[model samples]
Target: MSEALEQVAKNKDDVAANEAALEDLFCVISSYNPDFERDLITRAYAYSKSHHKGTLRKSGEDFISHPLGTARICADLMLDSVTIAAALLHDVVEDTPSTIPEVKKLFGDEVAELVDGLTKLQKVSLKSEEEEQAENLRKMIVAMARDIRVILIKLADRTHNMRTICHLDKHKQIQKAKETLEIYAPLAHRLGIYSIKWELEDLAFAALHPRKYSELQQMVSQRRTDRESYVAMAALQLEKELNNVGIQVKIEGRAKHFYSIYTKMVRKGKEFNEIYDLTAMRVLVDTVKDCYGALGIIHSIWKPMPGRFKDYIAMPKFNMYRSLHTTVIGPQGKPLEIQIRTQKMHQTAEFGIAAHWLYKEKGSSAKSKEQAADKLAWLRQMMEWQSETDDPKEFMKTLRIDLFEEEVFVFTPKGEVISLASGSTPIDFAYAVHTDVGHHCVGAKVNNRIVPLHHTLHSGDFIEVLTSKSSHGPSRDWLNFVQTSRARNKIRQWFKKERRQDSEHIGREQLQEALRRKGLASQKIVASPEFSELTRSMGFLKTEDLYVSLGTGKTSAQQVVTRITRDMDSVPDLA
Candidate 1:
């Protein structure tokens, strides 16, 4: 190697070494907390460094740099000292010789417990790759339910991992990138951590769909100058207008991320130029009163598109994201998205639950705890349902379906608001209320108008479930229609124990009928060698279990038969 090239490489290594940035993190954490335990955190850093003595990442950088970056991310959230410490040591037990007992002795039970949670969530292969991911996600969610900090630290860890993903094999990069986009990004969004959510989506997008991401990146880059100029003009106009109204405002322009644009394109079937929010602006101001005032001034300045305004501040989202959004007709005959929020709201929107500590708490710890419990109730419920649901594939499907959905807000008869995934029926509403309510649910009145059990709920609808003591229980059809895991489980549980013979008989009958329709016989199909493989592939133990699953409404008979037929076709003369 040439000396000049070696010197340049040394400089690059110096740049890549992130220890100096970690020092900045130490200063930031200590700045907010003067008496912060600098020694304790530094001790964790020293221990992790010692344990990861001579490791390197696929990026050819020091392995310790990953955890250091993760720790910095945690510090950016202004998390508690213990959380930051755990972030520093998250990968130690997984990748190094460090043990949980050692972590406990060195860092105390709190840090050790968090680290154990991360360790116990190791990805285990079930029957297939899908099953492995589902089981892994289940464990992670269950752990997250126990302690919210687990997910926060995991997000930070994932953030650093994705940021340095370039060093990985192309296939692994695509795999991790897809996982980040499909799972972690939504998890972060569900937690209301926009700071993590937006970047994770973009990074994952870049890795998974490199050419498309590059195209979008270049498209946005090409418009950067014009967009910046428009935003500058708009900001001056809006700031001046708000100032005239005795409101102080800070304005900034935001370019929508590549993944967000790609999602819009795919979901809405829109082109890049058709995305109105690409060139957007944010107006941060003092006081909620000023926030609303700025909105009024913005509306006066430009005509707002009808129905484009969402008052998230008045009714915060399930993740506690608070801001007011609107779309206005802007200077170049283009639509502009404008978000108005107080400084506190902006902080909370960015950091999510972490902001609770960063900003001074408005309520007592007891109230904060109550709010946190409310926010994580859905997660706890999903994890609890995992044990009740027999099929891990079904459980994973339900988990993903329920996790990323937009919710509808409904009012109970007593006027208490309940939030549920959009498209959830009144049966889902009853189950969301309670298991007994769902089990006993016979009919419902949506908005005081009597409706069937399958009546789809909408935001602002008032629902009253009518139960009868004499009612037999949930119908099997509820499995086909009910949108919540809780409701589905309650119904599945009823049939699972109520009539095994009847369910088995029905299951057999259904499978026979399906086979007959396909011009095949049930016995011949079941006796085939591929039948057991088919059952196992479906996450069933035996043919009888598959029948029972079909009868009990845990799975589909037609779907299973269709799969069997496809498998049979793949091998000639199977029977």
Candidate 2:
């Protein structure tokens, strides 16, 4: 059969599948909305199909199937009609010649606006494929300024694509997988979509490096039968023990992700057999009190691993993920991590951002809704940052640093908890709390130990910042000492506005020093077309302006040097 014919057949199958999925999805919606907007959803799906009629994806599936899958995921989230409609038409403008006006005509202005918000700029070009990808990411962020739902829908589409990426070529598979790992996964994390983020990472890791993927998969699969049996027996025992104590709990087991396993192996230099807690049992109870009550029962039955306990219920992760993690040695002397949480935490863990819909559907308490809303604040902040920053490269850089970094939880003297990226110093924490705290920071106390402000905080560390009124505001050097982009950006903003002359002077000296180390002075190098073009390509209009921007901390020095070398390599030598 011809490729086009195969695609048409596949699309027919997809449409059928989507109908079933949509039917199930409508049931969920029916519980929430007495009069579900079924007509609008049908119209959106029909419009998507018509818009993408002749187009086939690299996987030889009809392009419309992608949008339908995205819409199904959105509907599963119980998102508003506008969001679901947007998901249906998200790729119409970007992948097809169908205009926003066409979408507006077919659906409505709200749907069209979302489609436009999700569309990528078609005309921008960059010198390298990597640069082009980065620029495309920036364009996406810019589009996010119009509406946050656009990016959310795009993320869902990417997740579904990654799941089915095996149909693409090896090269394309790796490319798409890498994009998912670097861009879409991080975007999902920032949006508090942990389930999507985890799956995206695991799938992308599997496709990009099949050898390691299969190795870990085999290792994980080998013990699955035994692991299931152990968990079942343990859960049964725990249930009876808890039931005798008048406590109710739901217990289940989950295997760790391949990427997560591989990461631990690489970091700890441990073989697969050395890694304990591969399969974990989770207990969900009715109330927070019950969560602790269940935890005590588990500990009474099994010996808990020393120093392997975490209470996120009191001080949750930045994403608002809450649970009590305790590694305990079970009946066989095998280490097993048991997670204790309330039913709310289980829903958040499984559905993440979609938990909002679940809560709304069930008429959950106001506290539950507020908890979900509080977690979404980060997403709003990300959208705001994208709006305030015009530099796409900067936005991408900040996002990469934030998304890929792990976090540590610390506490203030009054017992208020603060979360910072792992490797973050007190300076990062001070800045995270408030700019004034960072600016006036003189010293820090980690667990009451008088430490320098650069001390990296660990979990459960009680931090106290020592401030001096006579002390100067944050030094330019503090920027380098901080781990988070939030701290670094605030430092730069202060220097950019408050100490312009000093910043310019320091920036100039730094540039000259960097050039001197590179064996190319500004006088000799700035005159070269390679250098000038490199600066221009990096978004600076002039070579001196580039240096000044670097000095003022607006642009990164390393990026400037790397671009110069790359530009020089591309220039034809005339000996």
lDDT of candidates 1 onward, in order:
0.83, 0.76
Give the distance in Å from residue 364's predicted Cα in candidate 2 to where it truly belongs.
Answer: 15
The deviation in Å at residue 115 for candidate 1 is 1.5
Q: lDDT tens string, model 1, 394-429?
A: 877887786788888889989898988889999999
- Runs in model 1 deviating more than 4 A are 1-18, 357-371, 500-575
Q: Report model 1's TM-score to 2 decimal places.
A: 0.82
TM-score of each: 0.82, 0.78
Give per-residue lDDT, candidate 1, residue 137.
85
Q: For every candidate structure, what is the RMSD over all alpha carbons to the true structure, in angstroms? A: 10.1, 10.0
The C-alpha local distance difference test score for the whole of candidate 2 amounts to: 0.76
Across 405-446, the per-residue lDDT of candidate 2 in tens digits comes to: 778888889988777889999998887788788889998988
